[model samples]
Target: MTKPTPLSGFPELLPAQRIAELAVIDHLRRTFELHGFASIETRIVETLDRLAKGGEIDKEIYVLRRLHADDDSSDSGLALHFDLTVPFARYVLENSGRLEFPFRRYQIQKAWRGERPQEGRFREFTQADVDIVARDELGLHYDVEVARVMAEALADLPLPPMTLQTNSRRLIEGFYRGLGVADPHLVISIMDKLDKAAAEVISRRLVDEAGLDDEQALLCLRLAEIRTRDTSFVEQVRALGVEHELLETGLTELAAVIDGCADVSSDRFRVEANLRIARGLDYYTGTVFEIYMEGHESLGSVGGGGRYDA
Candidate 1:
C-alpha cells in the first residue's frame, strides 16, 4: 500500500493543536461581542467575477472545478475566496434590504490563495476581521475605532508589542499627481515594493516602466522613507514642497486618524504614520493599515485592512 501524502498548502492540525486554536477564536468572539459587534459568516466561495474586479488580485485566486465534467465543460465561474473583505462587501450589497445602517460585524474564517510557499508567507491562512460598514457615508471616527479595537484585541492575545503602520492612499496619490505624474496608480504599485527592493532598483523601474524622470523618482524615494509616531510626519510631507488640495486633505485626514487613536490612550499598541504602505489594492482609496510586531518585522503584517470609500 502507498503512504498517504499531505497536501502542500492545506494543513490539518492535530487534535491538541486544534484545541489551542479554538481557545484563541473564543477570546476573539468574546472581545467582539463585548464591543457590540454582531457575528456573521459568509460562504467559503465567491464568484470569480467579483474576485477579479480589482485586477491586482487575478494572480492570487484559486479557481474551483467540477468533479465529473466533459472536456468541453467550463469551470463554474466560482473560486474559493482569497480574503474575507471582498465577500463581506458582496454580502452587504445582496442583503442591503435586511441590514441596518453602519453595520458592525466580526468575521473569522479560513481563506485560500494561489501564492507560492515562501518564508513568512502562506497559501492558506486564517483571518479575523472586524469591520463597520455603513449605508450613505461612514464617519472618519470609525477608522480610528477600527485601530483601537484591533489594538486592544492584539493586546489581549499573547503576542509581543505591535505597531500599526498606517498611511493614506490619497496622500501618496495626491503627492504623485501634484508632481505632474500622469499615472499615480502605477507609481503607487511600484512604490509599494520599496520595502522589498532597494531605492536604486525602484528608481530604475520608475524611470524604465513608469516613465518618471530621475529627479521625480528620487523625490518619491525620499517620501517613502518617512515614518513617524506622532504628527511629525505632516511636516515631513509638507517639506517635500509639492502642494495640492488632495494632498492637503490627505495629510489632515491622516493626522486626525493618528491623533484620534493616540488620544484614546491606545499606548498599549504603538501606531505610526508610515507613508510607504500602499496596500496594493486599488479600491483602498483612503487610509491603509499594516500591523507588524516590534521584533518580528520580517514576518510581514499579521493583520491589515483600510478604508475603501468607493
Candidate 2:
C-alpha cells in the first residue's frame, strides 16, 4: 500500500482533539440560540467574483475546478469561500424577498483560504459567526448586542481568559478626514501591520506612500497608539486636540458598545478600546473587534468581526 503525505495547510486533527472541538461547538450553538440568533448555513462555495470583493483577500482565495472539465467550458467561475461574511451577504440578497427584516443569524462552518499556515493562522478552519442583517439600517445597539453574546460564549469555554478589543471605523475615518489626510484607507492598511512593522516604517510609508504631511501622519500614528480598558478612550481622543463630527459620532457609538457589554458579562469578560486595531476590510463601517488571550499576543486574534453597513 502507498502512503499519503500530510499536507501543510489542510490539517487533520486526532480523535481526542476532534472530541474537544465538538464540545466547544456545542457550547457555542447553545449560547447563540439562547440569544435568539437563529442558526443558518451557507453553501461551502460561492462565485469567485463575490469573494474577490474582499480587497486583499482576493489573493488568498482557493478556486475550485473539476478534474475532468473541458478547458473551454463556459462556466463563469467558482471558488471555495474564504470566509463566512461574503457568502452570508450573498445569501441576504438572494433570499431577501422571503426573509424578515433585521435577520439575526448564527453560522458555524469550515472556511478555506490559500494563505500560509502558522500558529493562529489556518488554511482551513471552523469558525462561529453571529451577524445581524437589516433591509436598510442596522441599529447601533445590535453592535453591543453581538459583543455581549460573544463575551458570554467565551466565558463558558474552558480556554484561558480573553479580551474583546474594539475600535470604530467611523472613529478612524472621521479622525483621518478631520486631520486632512488624503487617503485614510491607505494609511489604515499600513497601520494594520503595526504589530510586525516598525513605527518608523509606518511613519515613512504614511509620508512617502500615502502622501501625508509629517503633522497629519504623526497624529494618525498617535491616535493608533491609544488603548483604553473602558470608556476613557473618549477623553484620549479629546486630549489629541482634534475634532470632527464623524469622530464625535464614532466615540458615542463605541462608548455605547462598551457600556452595553458591561451589562451582559461584567465579571466574565473584558472589553477595550484599542485604536490601533483597524480591520483591513473597508466594508466594516461601524464598530470593529479582535479577541485575544491575555499575554498571548503571539497567537494573534482568535476571533473578530464587526458592522458592515453596506
Output the number of the lDDT-best candidate. Answer: 1
Error of 2 at 108 (Å): 0.6
Candidate-wise lDDT, in order: 0.87, 0.86
- Count of backbone clashes, every candidate in sequence: 0, 0
Least accurate 10 contiguous residues by lDDT in model 1: 66-75
Q: TM per model?
A: 0.89, 0.91
Per-residue error at 297 for model 2, in Å?
1.5
RMSD of 1: 2.8
Please state every model's RMSD to the true fold in angstroms: 2.8, 2.3
**lDDT by residue for model 2 (218-259), tens:** 898899989987788999898888888999999999989988
TM-score leader: 2
Q: Residue pairs in steric clash, candidate 1?
A: none
